[model samples]
Target: MKVTLKLPKPRNPLVAPARARKAGAHASYNPARKVRRTEKHKLNQALSGRKTEGSYDA
Candidate 1:
Protein backbone atom coordinates (compact mmCIF):
# COMPACT_ATOMS: atom_id res chain seq x y z
CA MET A 1 0.00 0.00 0.00
CA LYS A 2 1.13 3.58 -0.75
CA VAL A 3 0.36 6.58 1.39
CA THR A 4 0.70 10.23 0.51
CA LEU A 5 -0.03 13.61 2.08
CA LYS A 6 -0.57 17.08 0.68
CA LEU A 7 0.77 20.00 2.75
CA PRO A 8 0.79 23.77 2.26
CA LYS A 9 3.87 25.26 0.70
CA PRO A 10 6.55 26.80 2.90
CA ARG A 11 6.26 30.44 3.86
CA ASN A 12 8.67 33.37 3.47
CA PRO A 13 10.63 34.07 6.64
CA LEU A 14 12.25 37.46 6.17
CA VAL A 15 9.12 39.61 6.09
CA ALA A 16 7.28 40.77 9.19
CA PRO A 17 4.55 38.45 10.45
CA ALA A 18 1.72 40.90 11.19
CA ARG A 19 2.18 43.12 8.15
CA ALA A 20 -0.47 42.18 5.59
CA ARG A 21 -0.86 38.89 7.47
CA LYS A 22 2.40 37.59 6.12
CA ALA A 23 3.36 33.93 6.42
CA GLY A 24 6.23 32.30 8.33
CA ALA A 25 7.43 32.63 11.90
CA HIS A 26 8.30 36.08 13.30
CA ALA A 27 11.81 36.86 12.14
CA SER A 28 11.98 40.44 13.48
CA TYR A 29 10.77 39.62 16.98
CA ASN A 30 13.67 37.30 17.71
CA PRO A 31 15.73 38.69 20.62
CA ALA A 32 18.79 36.60 19.83
CA ARG A 33 19.60 38.51 16.65
CA LYS A 34 20.68 41.62 18.50
CA VAL A 35 22.77 39.58 20.91
CA ARG A 36 24.44 37.67 18.11
CA ARG A 37 25.13 40.85 16.13
CA THR A 38 26.74 42.56 19.07
CA GLU A 39 28.75 39.49 20.01
CA LYS A 40 29.92 39.07 16.40
CA HIS A 41 30.89 42.73 16.17
CA LYS A 42 33.01 42.44 19.29
CA LEU A 43 34.60 39.23 18.10
CA ASN A 44 35.39 40.79 14.75
CA GLN A 45 36.99 43.77 16.40
CA ALA A 46 39.03 41.53 18.66
CA LEU A 47 40.21 39.41 15.75
CA SER A 48 41.13 42.51 13.73
CA GLY A 49 43.11 43.85 16.70
CA ARG A 50 41.03 47.04 16.74
CA LYS A 51 40.56 48.83 20.06
CA THR A 52 37.05 49.71 21.12
CA GLU A 53 35.75 52.22 23.64
CA GLY A 54 34.45 49.42 25.82
CA SER A 55 36.75 47.17 27.90
CA TYR A 56 35.80 44.12 25.84
CA ASP A 57 38.70 41.73 25.17
CA ALA A 58 38.75 38.23 23.68
Candidate 2:
Protein backbone atom coordinates (compact mmCIF):
# COMPACT_ATOMS: atom_id res chain seq x y z
CA MET A 1 0.00 0.00 0.00
CA LYS A 2 1.10 3.51 -0.81
CA VAL A 3 0.35 6.63 1.19
CA THR A 4 0.14 10.25 0.10
CA LEU A 5 0.19 13.29 2.31
CA LYS A 6 -1.20 16.76 1.66
CA LEU A 7 0.96 19.58 2.92
CA PRO A 8 -0.20 22.96 4.09
CA LYS A 9 0.95 26.25 2.56
CA PRO A 10 3.87 28.14 4.10
CA ARG A 11 3.70 31.24 6.28
CA ASN A 12 6.01 33.83 7.83
CA PRO A 13 7.24 35.21 4.53
CA LEU A 14 8.24 38.89 4.45
CA VAL A 15 6.27 41.22 2.24
CA ALA A 16 7.36 43.77 -0.34
CA PRO A 17 5.52 46.88 -1.47
CA ALA A 18 4.62 47.28 -5.11
CA ARG A 19 6.86 49.55 -7.12
CA ALA A 20 4.00 51.01 -9.14
CA ARG A 21 1.24 53.00 -7.58
CA LYS A 22 -2.17 51.42 -7.67
CA ALA A 23 -4.26 53.02 -10.40
CA GLY A 24 -7.94 53.67 -9.93
CA ALA A 25 -10.56 54.18 -12.61
CA HIS A 26 -7.87 55.93 -14.65
CA ALA A 27 -5.89 52.70 -14.82
CA SER A 28 -5.88 50.66 -18.00
CA TYR A 29 -5.30 46.95 -18.46
CA ASN A 30 -2.58 45.76 -20.76
CA PRO A 31 -3.79 42.67 -22.57
CA ALA A 32 -0.15 41.90 -23.24
CA ARG A 33 0.95 41.41 -19.66
CA LYS A 34 -0.39 37.87 -19.60
CA VAL A 35 1.34 36.81 -22.76
CA ARG A 36 4.63 38.39 -21.75
CA ARG A 37 4.63 36.57 -18.44
CA THR A 38 3.47 33.12 -19.53
CA GLU A 39 4.97 32.73 -22.95
CA LYS A 40 8.54 33.60 -23.88
CA HIS A 41 9.36 34.89 -27.37
CA LYS A 42 5.69 35.17 -28.05
CA LEU A 43 3.93 38.45 -28.77
CA ASN A 44 0.52 39.19 -27.36
CA GLN A 45 -2.31 38.41 -29.72
CA ALA A 46 -3.57 41.92 -29.06
CA LEU A 47 -0.44 43.12 -30.87
CA SER A 48 -0.26 40.34 -33.46
CA GLY A 49 -1.38 42.72 -36.22
CA ARG A 50 0.36 45.88 -35.09
CA LYS A 51 3.46 47.51 -36.55
CA THR A 52 6.63 47.99 -34.47
CA GLU A 53 9.46 48.47 -36.99
CA GLY A 54 9.39 52.21 -36.49
CA SER A 55 11.45 52.45 -33.31
CA TYR A 56 11.26 49.22 -31.27
CA ASP A 57 12.82 45.73 -31.65
CA ALA A 58 16.04 47.35 -32.77
Candidate 3:
Protein backbone atom coordinates (compact mmCIF):
# COMPACT_ATOMS: atom_id res chain seq x y z
CA MET A 1 0.00 0.00 0.00
CA LYS A 2 1.12 3.60 -0.78
CA VAL A 3 0.05 6.92 0.70
CA THR A 4 0.17 10.46 -0.75
CA LEU A 5 0.12 13.75 1.18
CA LYS A 6 -0.92 17.19 -0.05
CA LEU A 7 0.24 20.60 1.29
CA PRO A 8 -1.62 23.93 1.28
CA LYS A 9 -0.38 26.86 -0.81
CA PRO A 10 1.85 29.38 0.92
CA ARG A 11 0.43 32.86 1.57
CA ASN A 12 1.87 36.02 -0.02
CA PRO A 13 4.84 37.24 2.06
CA LEU A 14 4.44 40.97 1.31
CA VAL A 15 1.05 41.25 3.08
CA ALA A 16 2.44 40.44 6.57
CA PRO A 17 5.21 43.09 6.87
CA ALA A 18 2.96 45.91 5.57
CA ARG A 19 0.33 45.04 8.18
CA ALA A 20 2.91 44.87 11.00
CA ARG A 21 4.53 48.24 10.15
CA LYS A 22 1.14 49.99 10.21
CA ALA A 23 0.27 48.57 13.65
CA GLY A 24 3.29 49.95 15.57
CA ALA A 25 6.44 52.08 15.35
CA HIS A 26 9.51 50.47 13.83
CA ALA A 27 12.74 49.98 15.80
CA SER A 28 16.21 51.20 14.78
CA TYR A 29 19.50 49.44 15.38
CA ASN A 30 22.52 51.16 16.88
CA PRO A 31 26.18 49.96 16.95
CA ALA A 32 27.74 49.07 20.30
CA ARG A 33 30.73 50.80 21.87
CA LYS A 34 34.16 49.23 22.49
CA VAL A 35 34.50 47.04 25.60
CA ARG A 36 36.03 48.59 28.75
CA ARG A 37 39.27 47.39 30.32
CA THR A 38 37.55 46.17 33.50
CA GLU A 39 35.01 44.19 31.46
CA LYS A 40 37.76 42.70 29.28
CA HIS A 41 39.83 41.73 32.32
CA LYS A 42 36.91 40.02 33.97
CA LEU A 43 36.03 38.09 30.83
CA ASN A 44 39.64 36.99 30.42
CA GLN A 45 39.86 35.84 34.02
CA ALA A 46 36.61 33.94 33.77
CA LEU A 47 37.69 32.11 30.63
CA SER A 48 41.33 31.41 31.60
CA GLY A 49 40.99 31.24 35.41
CA ARG A 50 43.80 33.74 35.99
CA LYS A 51 43.96 37.50 36.64
CA THR A 52 45.44 39.64 33.88
CA GLU A 53 48.65 41.42 34.79
CA GLY A 54 48.94 44.91 33.27
CA SER A 55 48.77 48.63 34.06
CA TYR A 56 45.12 49.72 33.54
CA ASP A 57 45.73 53.37 34.38
CA ALA A 58 47.55 55.45 31.81
Candidate whose TM-score is highest? 1
Candidate number with greatest lDDT: 1
TM per candidate: 0.41, 0.20, 0.31
Candidate 1: stretches off by over 4 Å: 1-26, 52-54
Candidate 2 whole-model C-alpha lDDT, 0 to 1:
0.52
Question: Candidate 2, residues 1-58: lDDT per residue as tens digits?
Answer: 9998998987545433443556476435776865576453334533674544342352
The order of the candidates by TM-score, greatest first, is 1, 3, 2
Residue 29 lDDT in candidate 3: 38
Model 2 off-target regions past 4 Å?
A: 15-58
- Report lDDT (CA) for all predictions: 0.76, 0.52, 0.62
- The candidate, 1 or 2, that scores higher on lDDT is 1
Candidate 1, after superposition: displacement of residue 34 in Å? 0.8
Distance (Å) between predicted and true CA of 7, model 2?
Answer: 0.8
Tell me the lDDT of candidate 1: 0.76
Q: Please tell me which model should have the higher TM-score, number 1 or number 2.
A: 1
What order do candidates take by lDDT, descending?
A: 1, 3, 2
Q: Residues 6-36, candidate 3, lDDT per residue (tens digit)? A: 9899999998898887564345332332346
